[model samples]
Each structure stands twice: as structure tokens, then as C-alpha cells.
Target chain A: MQKSRDYAEWYSRYIDDELSAEEKQAFLKYLDENPQEKAIVQRLQSLQQNLAQLPPTDTSEGFETVLRTRIQIEKKIGYGAIHTFFQRWRMPFLGFATALVVFLVFSGLKGIRWDGMPTDETAVNHASMQNSLSLPASNINYTLDQFIASPSYSTDAASIHYQPAEDETMNKNQGVVVDSTGKIKQETTKTIPENLQLSY
Target chain B: MEGREEQSKGKKPSDEELIARFQQGDIYAFDLIVKRYKQQLLNFVFRFLNNRELAEDVVQETFLRVYRKRHAYKQVAKFSTWIYTIAGNLSRTELRRRKRRKLFSLSDIGMEEKDYEIASDEFNPEKYTNTVMHEKIIQREINKLSSKFREVILLRDVQGLAYEEIAEIVNVPLGTVKSRVNRARLRLQEQLKKSL
Candidate 1:
């Protein structure tokens, strides 16, 4: 029992030299009784001795100076850069701007019409005339009634049939008579051949 | 009256206090902490890595981490334990990195032998050859140790940290720390005995 307690106490005190005298005596007696335990203690003591003999590592000279400089630089740069970058642009604003730019880019790629394309007013007027000519005489009455209701349509019936061509000769040669309903009616003169078909 | 006496005695401010002051912009206090622990930290790293320059870098990195994390420090454990934990983590990372780089690069295969030769050449010629040889043997034995056991032995035997402190640093139980240290010391002694 004494030997067991002695060994346990020695094991605890082996880490530091705070062992009391009685504890040391008891441990010695325990070691004498237990050869295996004695061997273990000896090994531990040698290990301690070797650890103590280890040379002190040197860390002087420019090491501290360099370390301090690095730390200061890291602190200054790390916090400030993140803060400055994030502070300048809120995430939502940046995301919105990015989305807008991407949308413009893709839309441009797909050839969305811009406001600057030339308008063919003459072509549009010709297309409208063609559409009116293609309609049946009954639909023409309804369309005419709607067009007259609009303030932009003129009230003169003769003016509606007479669209002045750019060339005066072409208009006379064509001599195409269009009714109020915009159906082109050919008028035959005795001088002109009956089989002659004129088309505009 | 007791408080006044305690103040009059002026017990050194604990590591946590010093760290708090450091976080509050007391650079001198930090400097004192560094001065106090740099050698031990360097020694710990040097033994673990077996490379002086790498050890120095690890020590610097450890201190930098500690300083950066100063604000998060609680006084739950000793400051030494915290600092050691940082060192251990950094050293382990460095070791892993080195292993990975070595596996990929394969350029420095013979560098350790060359370094050993260089180290031997730099030693004193006349008086301390045996001591130097003994140190080299010990260094080789330490290198042979598994990293976990090596760390335990280093923390306990070389650094003189308590088992509890080591447990905190290693994030293990006190019993584990003691057992690991004991096993590592035994292994080291066995190796030394065989060499002798």
C-alpha cells in the first residue's frame, strides 16, 4: 500500500520539482521494491535531462522589426481595403448596374431596333393605298366612315383619289381613275387600243 | 484593504490583460508579450519543423494571428495556451503544405541530406563535436516521431507546459495529453538507448 502511494506521488511530482522530502523518500523506497518502475523513472529522468540540454533558440536581430512591420502593414491594408471597396458600392446597387449592362449587351447582340433607324414615310403611304385598294367595296364604306371620323382625314373626295406622282408625265400617261372607295377603274379612250392594259 | 494590498504588490497583468491592452492600441504591451514568448515559440516551431527559417516564419505567422484575433480573446485559458495553439496549427498547416509541394514538385528530395552536411560543416571544429553529434541524433529521433506524439512530447518535455495547458492547446482531454507525452518520451528514450 505504501509502495503504491509512493509510486503514484512520484509520478505526479516528476513533472515539477515541487516534491516534498517525505514524498521523495517514499518514492525511493518504492523504486527499490519495483525494478520496472525504477527503470521507467530512470528513462523519464534521462528524457528530462535531454530536454533541458536543448540549446535555446535565437530570435533576435531584425526578426522582431520585420514581424512588427508586417503586422502593421497587414492591419492597415486588410481592414481598410475591404472597408473602402465595400463602402463605395452597396451590393444591390452594383448588382443592379451589372444586370443593366448585361441586359443592354445581350439586347444589342439580338439586334433590338433603336430610335435612330430611318423612317420610309413614302413607302408607308404607298402601303396604305395598296391596303385600301385590296379591300372590298363594302369594307371600304366602313373604313371610309372610320377614317372620316378621325380629324386627320381630309373631307375632299377628289383629293382622296388624286395622289400626285413625283413625275407629271407618268401621272398623265397612267391616267388611272381611282373611285372614292380607292378601286382603280380603267377608262378606255377610242384612240387607245381596246386590248392595251395599263397598270400602276 | 486586501484589494489595496494586491494593487500595491502590483502583480503582473495577466496575458489576457496585456492582449486586451494590445487590442486597445497598446503596441508596447504587445511588444512585451512578443519579447516574453518569442524564444519559446520559435523553439517549439524549430523542433516541429526542423527548419530554422520555416520555424521563424511560423513564429511570425503565429504572432500575427494572435494579434489579429486579439479582440476575440477570452480569459478562459492561459494566453500561452492560446499562442501555442496558434503555433501548433500554423506548423501543422505548413507541414502539410510542404508534404503536398514535395509530392508534386519532387525537386528537393536530397535537400535534407545536403542541409545536414552543411549544418555539420558549420559546427565548431575542436571542442563540441560530440555535443553537436548528440544534438543531431536527438534531432533525427525527433524527426522520426509521429507528428502527434512529437507535439505531445515537445509541449510537455521541451516547452515545460503542464498537461492541462497542453490539453487546452491541443484541444484534447488532460488524460490524453499525459498518455501521449508519456508514450512519446518512452519512444524517444527507446530510440536513444538503441543508438547508444
Candidate 2:
């Protein structure tokens, strides 16, 4: 049964002329010895031939037209709608891009701010800090002069004002120290208890 | 309507080129793709279900999916393989729906289209020489196989795809495709002998 089953598989390949030369010779020899199975091979070949000759099934006469119409409906209903959307908007996008580049070039040549627009940074001091600071969580780092221009003093004259935490309390678990001004103060471990592992 | 299926030079763009163009928003590329594949896919799906209308619908759905998911196709795989996979999946799903529908479908209450079968002439054993009758019997036998055997058999014997290509289309190991196809052929041969 197993030998015949192998021969049956080989018959399929044989019909297709797929068996290698040596295998083909062997398959033919086996078929000669087994006349009954040769009929089976003839049957498979006839079926294949009939299927092959089974008139190339032409689709319905309007097949292409129908498909095209369906695709057109799809085009309107968001099939490739993204592609269509970009196509419809392409010229506008190019126009917008050009306008942006022109605006950028003009702005670059002039001061970054058009004369009426105030581009100057806002000045914040202790008063602003008290209003906005979450002291324990804040860590702002900027000099007042960096933001506000000093009329009498040079901008270099100002130093970074390190804001201390309100009431100088440090949140130990968070290991963060802040001030009423949102600027962060550097924390120093001023007192280290003598531990065996450490050198003074 | 201006479908460019083949180049004037008789050297058409590769499937990859067409799909790439489709991806780049060239609707005509999709037209070419449709013209190229519709008949073959219809034949495949039609043979799968043994129903012309449903097969055409499945092929359309397959193309629609291809249109929607053009970006999903990568250059790494053959476009035919990718599209065939879609058609095959849709065909299988339709087959299952048909089987389930057969059980409960009543002509009066069917929300779906009424079952229109290929009217195979009453099994006349002596009429085996009639080619039309033979074709009908063969198609019926194909549809009656389990979906796996039916699928591999169609791809191999009817479509004549290489075992390697069939493997990739069906997403199976090459040996599995060969095994299933051989089994299908053996069964088909037996049934056809009896029928004819």
C-alpha cells in the first residue's frame, strides 16, 4: 500500500513532467510492472488535461467596467482617500510653504520681532517668585538681568540669585531644596556623622 | 477608463513598479494592477466557490483591500504572492460563510443572495464523455474537498503554481503544500474515476 501510495504521488509529479530523469525512469519501470496503476495515471492525466482545456473562463462581459465603477465609488468613499486628499491639497500646501519661507526670510533680515510685537523676555524677581513658586519642588535658574534690561548697570553686572527655600526647609525624602523664588538652591551636606567607612 | 495594462514596448512595468506607483498616488497604476489581476483572481475565487457572482465580489473586495492597504505591501515580497494571499483569505472566508449559510439559509428569509449553484446535470454515469458534464463534475468534486485540500489543489493543479510559490501564497512549509496537493489529487483521481 505504501509503495503504491508513493507511486501515486510520483504519478502526480510525472503528469507535470516534474520527476527528475532518474526518477522518471524508475517511475516508468514501476508503472510497467503494475498495469492496474497505469490506468490511474491515465485518469489523473486526463483530468488535468480537461481542466487545462476547460475554456479559459472569461469573466462577465462588463467585468472591467464594473470593477472600475466600484473603484470610483471607493475613491469617493475614502479608499485611497488619503492619497486623494493630499493630491487635492497639494497646491495649497506648496503655497503655504512658500509663504512661510518668505515670512521667515523677511523676519530673519529684520529683527526677529516685527516692530509692534514685543519679543522681549519678561523680568521676574522676588515678587514674581512669591506668586508662582512651589518652593519645595521648584528649581528655576536665571538672573533677573537675563530677562530684564538694566538701564544704569551693564547686563554683566547681575549675578544669578539663588533662591533659598521658604523658611529654609528642605524636603528630606525628596532630597530637594527650593526657595520662594522658583530658583533651586544648592544643598550642602554640612553635617556628616562620623561613620566607620568614611575618612574625614 | 484609460487603463494602461501593458506598455507600448511590450515591456510592462513590474508588479513592484506598479504597486510602488500606486503607493505614490498614481491611480493609473492601480488600474493596470486591476486589469492584470482581475481575471485570474476571479477564476481562482470562482473555482474556489464554484459561484461566479460571489467570486467576482470576493475579487473586488480583495482589490479594495489592496487599494486601502497599498502601503502595507513591501518591496521584499512579490506583488502576485501578496495579492493572491488576500484573494485566498477572502475566498476561504466566503466558503465558510457559504457552508454555514447552506445549513440555515432559507430562500424566503435570506438576507444574502439566494444560492445559485452551477447546475451540474444529474449524475449520468454513461455521459462521462460529455466534456461539459465532466467539467461540472470535476468542479463539484473540487468544492467538496476540505478547504485546505481544495486550496492547495486549486493553486497547484488548476493554477499550475510552483510548489515553492504555492507554499508562500498559502503560508505553509513547502513539504506541506506538496503533501496536501498529492492527497487532493489522489482523492480527486478516485472520485473522478467513479464519476466518469
Candidate 3:
């Protein structure tokens, strides 16, 4: 019975002439042993041929004229230009858009950690990390690499100690002396301002 | 001869070439495309919807889409497959709309009824009855087929499209198309056996 069913598939192939010449011979030999199967193949062939011959209907009248008119209207309004563009590109666009939305949703969820009051341990960790890091608004998205490399980063608990410098000491004891006493410099002692001059 | 030159020029531009021309905005090429596939699409849609009027509407819409979306067509597939896909989709949509209205245009209304009415009036009425009844039986069996089987059979047998093309048109794997076609042919025979 299983064998007969396998041969049944060949019936369509035989009818469609898809079988190789050798398979055609094999199918014929098999059919000769099976009259009922042979009859069925003959009938299927008849049916298919009848269907093939079934009159192909032509466009009623002025199908082109009507379609042309509709096309002219379509051109005028140019509707479905966007619709057709979307229709043609529907799948790829949908796929990209879906990926984008999903990514944004997930990323947005991840980004929202700093926005709301911390409710969960992860959010709390993020909040503490943000405050402890004192991340500047400009560098809000400071990454791990940046964190490690930042000047504020220290193994010891060293907080920032910013201090203003004095302007007086910032200026140099302006000139170079060859020795403590023998100052055959560029004869610039007269040119030196009192505060900037080196004391002999 | 000028006619020969026109024929050579005509060398029958392939459907691809015609559409290529149409894509280049040759209105004449567009006219040729409409003329070429119009009837074939009509018959396919007509069989699919089993409604002459609606089938024409669907075919018209199919062409309108081809015209509007001419630039969207790529050479990756045959133009016939592309157009048939359009017609087939419209036909299926119309089929769903038809089901909503609970209207099946089988023998209760169809081409067979109108075919004999026109042919018999012009020719022998007696002969027309027998032939028409036979065709009516076949058509009814065709209508009895599930939409899945019906579409495949129509594409494979009636329209004489390649299995690959049918597969593309129906968006099924080639193996599935082969089996569906085989089973559909058998089912059609089994049904026609009883009635015919």
C-alpha cells in the first residue's frame, strides 16, 4: 500500500510529462499491472486537458481604456506612490523598523535607569554609580574605559581637592645668573623689573 | 518590406523588454503590456474568484498596480510571475470579500451558463446542452476544490506556468506546490468521477 502511494505521486508527474523517459516506461509498466490506477491516470489527464481548454476569458470591453483612465487618475493624485513604495518594500521596511523599535525599546529601558527614582537593585546601583562617579553632564555616557582612565580615578579614596594658585610666585625670579656673584649676564640688570629681578 | 522591418523590430520584445521600455516611460510599451497579460490574468482571476465581473475588476487593479509600481519590479523574477502574483492576490482578497457576503458563484452563476446562452443562440442548441453540462460538471468540480488546490491546479494546468513560477506566485516551496498539484488533480478526478 505504501508502495502504491509512492507511485500515486508519479501519476501527476506522468500526466505533466515530468518523468524521465525511463521513469515513463516504468510508470507505464506499473500501470499495465494496475487497471484501476491506469483508469484514474487517464481520467486525470482528461480533466487536466479539459481544464486547459476551458475558455480563457478576455477583458470585457475597454479594459485598457478604463485601466488607463484609472492610471491617469492615479498619476494625477499619485496616491499609492507612497503606498506602493511601502507595499513593495513592506517586508524589509517592517523588518528594519521592527528591529529598530525593539532595539530602541530595549536600549530605552536600559537608558531609563538614571531617569526615574531607583526602584530595583540594578536601578539603585546605577544611581549610586552615577552620583559616586560625579559624571559631568557633558560626559554622561562615560564608559568603563573612560572611568578607568579618568584623572579622578584612584585606588586610594582620594577626592578632588581643587585649589587656586597665587599669581606672585607663578612669575619666575626672572633672569639666569652664571654664579652667585659673577653676573656677566646679557647686561640686563637695568632692564629687569624690580619684582622680577634676581637679587645679587 | 516595411511590414517585415516592423515585424523584425517587433521581433516580439520579451515581457521583460516591454516592461523595461515601460519603465523608461514608453507609454506604448505600457499599452502592449496591458494588451498582453490582460486576458490571461482575467482568466486566472475569473477562475480564482469564479466571478467574471469581479475578476475583470481584479485584473484591472492588477494592471493599475503594475503601472504604478513599474519601477519596483526587479529582474530577479519573471515579469509573468510578478503580474500573476498581483492578480492572484487581488483574486484571493476578492474571494475573502465574497465569503463575507456568502456569495459563491459556482454553477448558480458562472461562465458556463453564459457560454451556452451566447453560443447556442448562434449555433446548434442541442449540442450546446451536452457540452455545456459536461463543462459545467468540470467547472463545479473546479469550484469544489479548496482554494489552495484550485489556485495551484489553475496555475499549473490551465495557465501552463512552470512549477517554479507557480511556487513563486503562490509563495510556497516547490515541493509543496508539486504535492498540492498532484493531490489537487486526484481530488478533482475523484469528485468528477461521481458527477460525470
Per-residue lDDT tens digits for candidate 1, residues A20-115, read 888778677778888877766776676676786788799858989998899778877896577667878778778999999999877655544455
* Best prediction by TM-score: 3
Best of the candidates, DockQ: 3
Residue A152 alpha-carbon offset, candidate 3, angstroms:
52
Model 1, backbone clash pairs (residues 3+ apart or across chains), number: 0
Candidate 1 per-residue C-alpha lDDT over B1-196 given as tens digits, one digit per residue, 9 for 90 to 100: 3323434798666677778778887777788789888999999999999999999999998888877778767878788988999999999999999878878887889776665443445445342223333577677778779999999888888888888889998898987877677667768877766654
Taking every candidate in turn, the Cα RMSD to the unseen true structure, in Å, is 16.8, 15.3, 17.8
TM-score of each: 0.58, 0.61, 0.62
lDDT of each: 0.68, 0.70, 0.72
Q: Candidate 1 — which residues are off by over 4 angstroms?
A: A1-37, A79-200, B1-12, B113-133
lDDT of 2 at B67: 83
Model 3 lDDT tens row, A7-105:
999999998889999989888988888888888888788777788888778787787788888988877887877677878998998999999999877
Ranking by TM-score: 3, 2, 1
Model 1 residue A30 CA deviation (Å) reads 6.7
